[model samples]
Target: MTRKLTPKEAAQRYLREREPDVARATLYNHRSLLKQWWQWCESQDIEYVNDIDGFDLAYFRLDRQMEVGEVTLYNQMTVLRVFTRWLQSRGLVANGLADGMVVAQPDDASRNTKIDSITAQQILSYLEKYEYPSLRHVVFAFLWHTGMRLGALRAIDLKDFHPKEHYVELHHRPETGTPLKNKEYSEREVNLALWCCSILDDYIEGRRHDVTDNYDRTPLFTTEQGRVSHSNVRDHINQITRPCDYTRECPHDREITNCEATTRLHAARCPSSIAPHDLRRSSVTYLLDEGHRKELVADRVDLSVRTMEEHYDKRSEAEKRKLRRDEFGMDG
Candidate 1:
C-alpha cells in the first residue's frame, strides 16, 4: 500500500538519501532552497506534495524569472525536481511537479563576457604600495600566485602546505571539508612556484606569531584572533578598494601618475568591481604566459582544460597593446 507523505517529510528523506560525500555547506544550501519552496507552498495555501502541479511549477519559474538569474533559477528548479521525483518514487505524489517544467536558457552574451585578469606586475605593485594586515596581504599573495579557489584556500589547514617540498596537497577527502568541484578523483598535488613558496613561508611564520592557541590546527588564512569567515575576506577586499581612483590617477597623491601608481590604483579598485574568482583566472594566465601547457596547468590547478580556455584566456589591455606595438615595430 502507498503512503502519503508531507513536503517536509519528503524533503528530509531526500536529504538523507543524498551522497555521503557531499559537503556540509552543499547540503545546507539544498536545505535552504527546500525551505524557500516550502514557504512558497504554505503562503499559497497549497498542499505542497499534493497540490503542486506542473503548472504551479511553471508559474513559480515565471514569477522568479526577473527576481533570480538564469543559473540560480536552473539550480532551484533542479532541487525542486529532485524533491518531486523523490515524492513520486515513494508514492507520495501522483506526478512529479517538475517533470514538464522549463527553465530559461542563459543569454549567450552575458555568459561570454570576459573576466579581467590581474597581471603579475599589477599584483606585485598592490602588495608593495597597499597597507593591509600582514596575514591578509599574504593570503592575497598566495591566491594570486597559487591559483587556489577561494573555498579551498579558506579550508586549507596548517599541514596542507609543504615548504620544503614546494608543493600543496589539495586533500579532497570527506573529513577535510573540501568539496571536489567535479568527480571524486579530481583531488591531486599541485606544485608551487618559488615565489609562492617564499610568501607562504612568511605567512605561516607570521600566523605563528599572531595566534597563541590551537595554532597547530588552525586555518592558513585568519584574522587576528583565529580563522576568518569568507564574508570577512569579501569585506576586506571592499575596504581596500573603496578609496581607489580608477581614472588612472592616484587618489592619495595626484602628482604620482606613473605606471606604478596607476597599477596600484587598478588593483585597489578591482576587488570591489570584480569577484574573487578573478584571482584564479589571473594565476592561470600567468602560468600560460610562463610556457605551461594547458592540460598540465589545468591538472595542477584542479580545473578542466575547457574551463581554463573559457574563463582564464583573457588578455589584458596592456598585454594587447604591447603585442600590437611589437608587431608594428612602433617606437614608444
Candidate 2:
C-alpha cells in the first residue's frame, strides 16, 4: 500500500526531484505554475493527492480558464498534467488522472504576435548608432541575431565566447546554476555575425562589467554584483524595445515626458514595447523569411522546426507566396 501524501507535499517533492533535471528558470516556472493548483487544492479542502480525480481536474481547469488566457491556461494545464502523471507514478494519485486533463489550444492571433523585421532593424540601427557596446545594445543585438532563449543567452561565460572562431559554445551546467532549457540536448555552438562579434568584442574590452558570479564563472553579461538576473535581462529588453525610447516618436500619441511607460519600471506597459520572447520569435521568422533552411535555423536557435513553424513563423501568406515566387523566378 502507498503512503498518503498531502497536495503540498506532493508538489514540493515533485519540484525538488525536478530541480536537478531542469534549468533554474524552468524549475522556477514549474514551481510557480503548480503553486496555483496546490493553492486551489487547499481552498477546496482536498487535502491529499489521492482525493484528486478527473472531475476535480476538470473543475480546476474551468476555474483557471476563467482567470487566464488560452495560452496561459494551456501552459498551466500542461504543467499540471505532468505533475498529475508524476503523482500517479508515486502511487499518490489514481492512474490515468493526467490523461483526463485537457490542455487549452491557443488561437492563431495569440500565437502569431511578434515584432516585424522593419521594426527590428530600426531598433538595431538605433542601438548601433547610439548605444553600441552598451549592455542594452549587446543583449538586444545578441537576442535578435542569434534567436537564442534568454536563459541560454544569460548562461554565456567569458570563456565560452570565441571572438577568434566567431562562435560561442553553450554548456549545461546546472551544478554551477546556469542550465540550458533542454539540458545537454540544448548545448551547441552558436555562430555570430562579424558585426555582432565586433559589438561583443567592444563591450568586453570597454563596457562589460568583468565580474564573476558566485560560482566564480565570469558571465559575458553582468553588473557589479555578478551574473545578471533573468528579470534584469527582461527589463532591459522591455526598456529598449519601447518605440519612444529609440524613435522619440510616440505612435500612441501620448506625451513622451508624461507617459508612465517612459519610466524604467513601467516600460512594459507601453503599447509598442515587446518582451524578449517576441524578439526570439521575430528572429526566427526573420531567418526563415530570409530563405534560411528550417533545419539550419532550428539548429542555430535551439528550437525544433515544428515548434518554429507552428509557433514562431509569423510571416503572412502573401510574404510566403512572394518568397516562393522569387525562388522559382516566376516574378519575371
Candidate 3:
C-alpha cells in the first residue's frame, strides 16, 4: 500500500522544494489554486491525495469548465498537471491524477477573431479633443503611436528615453523591479519615431513642474499621487472613457432633455470596447499596410514573425476590398 500524505502537507512540501527561480507572483497563483483544491477536498469529505485519481481529476476539471472560460480552464489544468507530476516525483501520491485530464480547446473561429485597431487619424482626433492633465494625455498619445506593450511602457524610466540618440534602450534590469516577460536577453533597443519624441518632450516639460527634486530615476509616467503601477494605468484608461451626462433641448421644444453622452473623441474618448494590447496590434497593422517588411516590423515591435502574422496581420473589410480592386483594375 502507498503511504498517504494530506493535501495541505503535500502542497506545503511541494512549494518549499519547487524551483527557486520561479517568479513570486506565479508561485502565489499556484498556491492559491492548490489551497482551493484542498478546501474542495475537505468539503467533499474526500481523501485529498490518496483518493484522487484520473476520474477525480476529470471531475474537478469538468467543474472548472462549467465556471471558467476555455483558456482559463486549460491554464488551470496545466497547473494541476504540473503539481500532480511533482507530487508523484515526491512519492506523496501513488498515481499521477493528471494522466487522463481533459481540457476543452478554444474554438478555431473565435481564435482568429480580431480587435479594432486604432488609426493615426483617430488618435490625432482623440488628442485634439482630450482635456486631461498634460502627462496623462502624453501617455495616451505615446501608447497610441508607438504601440508599446503596457509592461514595456511601465518599465520605462526617465533615463530610458534618449532624445539625442533617437532611440530608447530597453535594458534587462529585473533587479530594479521592472520584470520583462521574455527575460533578459530578449531586451532590445527600439527606435523612437519623431512624433513619439515630440510627445515625450512635451510630457517631460509638463512633468518638470510636478517634480520638486531632480530624480532621474522617476518613472516616465506618474499618477496623481506621483507613483504609478500597472493597474493604475489601466484604471486611468478606464476613467478616461467613462460616459458623461449632458443636457440637450427636447426636439419637441416642451421640456429640456437629459441624455448621457458618450463620445469617442480622442484617446480618452476611444471606445472602452478596445484594450491596450489592441493599440500594439493596430501599430503592427499600420506598419504592414505602409509596406514595412514582416521580419523588420516584428524585430522593432519585439514580437516573432509568427506572432505578428497570427494576430496583428488582420485586414479590415475596406482594406480587403481595396486590395481586390487594385489587383483586378476595377478603376480602369
Candidate 4:
C-alpha cells in the first residue's frame, strides 16, 4: 500500500532529507523552485502527492511557462522531476510518475537587452530621492554597484559587512543556509563606493527590521519575520524598474488603467522593466566601458574573464571601436 502525503508535506520532507547532500545554495534554489509547484498543488486542490499525474504536471508546465522565462521554466520542471522521483521511492507517488513528466529543453539564448549605465543611474537617483534608506533602495544600489548575483546578495550578513572599511566579505557557509554559488571559490571582499556605504549605513541604522533567520544569523536584508526571500528580492527589483514607478510616464504609451504590468505581481511584464540578472550584466558592461581592467572586473564579480567577455559584455561593436579610438588617441 502507498503512503499518503500532502504535496507540501512531501516537499518539506524532501528538502529536509536532501539538505545534507547538496550545497546550501543549491538547496535554497531547489526550495525556491519547488515552492511554485507546491502552491500550484494547493490551487488545484491536490490533497495528496499520489493525486498528481502526468496531466497535472503538463498543466503545471503550461502555467509556469506563462510566468517565467524558458530557462527558469526548465529549471523548475527539473527540480519537480527530482522531487517526484524521491516521492515515488517513498511510495508517496506512483512508479514511473517522474518518467511520465516531460521536461523541456532549455535554449541557451543570449539576452542582449540590459539596463545601460544612464538608465541605471536614473533608477538609482530616483530611489535615492524618493525611497532612500529603504530595502528597495539598498537592494538596487548593491546590485548595481557591486554586480553580485541574487544568491550572493541574499547571502550577505551583518557580520560580513565592514562599513568603516567600505567593503563586505562573501563567505560560504552551507550549514547556516547561506552559501555562495561557487562554494568557497565564490568568496571575496567587495569594496563599496562611499555613497553606497553611506546609504547602507542609513538603512541598517534606521529602517532595517531587527530579525534573525532560522540559523540565528542577522541578514543584511530582512522582512519582519526573518531574512528576505529570493522571490521578494526579485520582486522588489521588478517593481522599482518599471518606468512608470520612477519616471511617471510609460515609454510604451500604454494606459495605466488598462495596463496589467502596472500591477505589482506583473511588473516584470513591462517592456521597460529590467530583471536582476540583466542589471548585473549591465554593471559588468558599464565597468568594462569605463576602461576598467577585465581581470579586476572578473575578480570583483566572481566570474572568469572569458565568461565575462563572451556572456556579460553587452557592448556593441561601435561602442568598442569608440573606446579603442579614445584609448589610442585616435579621437581628434
**Ranking of candidates on lDDT, top first:** 4, 2, 3, 1
TM-score of 3: 0.57
User: Pairs clashing in candidate 1?
Assistant: none
lDDT of 4 by residue, 151-246 (tens): 899899998889999999999887887778889999999999999999999999999999999999999988898988888888888888888898
lDDT of 3 by residue, 217-294 (tens): 567676555435655554444333332211222222232222211322222222232345655676778777666677
User: Residue 35 of model 4: what lDDT?
Assistant: 78
TM-score per prediction, in order, is 0.59, 0.73, 0.57, 0.81
Tens-digit lDDT string for candidate 1 (32-54): 77877776766677754655577
Query: Lowest lDDT 10-mer window, candidate 4?
Result: 104-113
State each model's CA lDDT, in order. Answer: 0.61, 0.86, 0.62, 0.87
Counting only residues 3 or more apart in sequence or on different chains, how many pairs clash (N, Cα, C under 3 Å) in candidate 1?
0
lDDT of 2 at 82: 90
Where does the lowest 10-residue lDDT sum fall in candidate 2? 104-113
Better of 3 and 4 by lDDT: 4
**Clashing residue pairs for model 2:** none
Q: Write the number of the candidate with greater lDDT, choosing between 1 and 4.
A: 4
What's the CA error at residue 193 for candidate 2, in Å?
1.0
Candidate structures ordered by TM-score, highest first: 4, 2, 1, 3
Between which residue pairs do clashes occur in model 4? none
- Model 4 scores a TM of 0.81
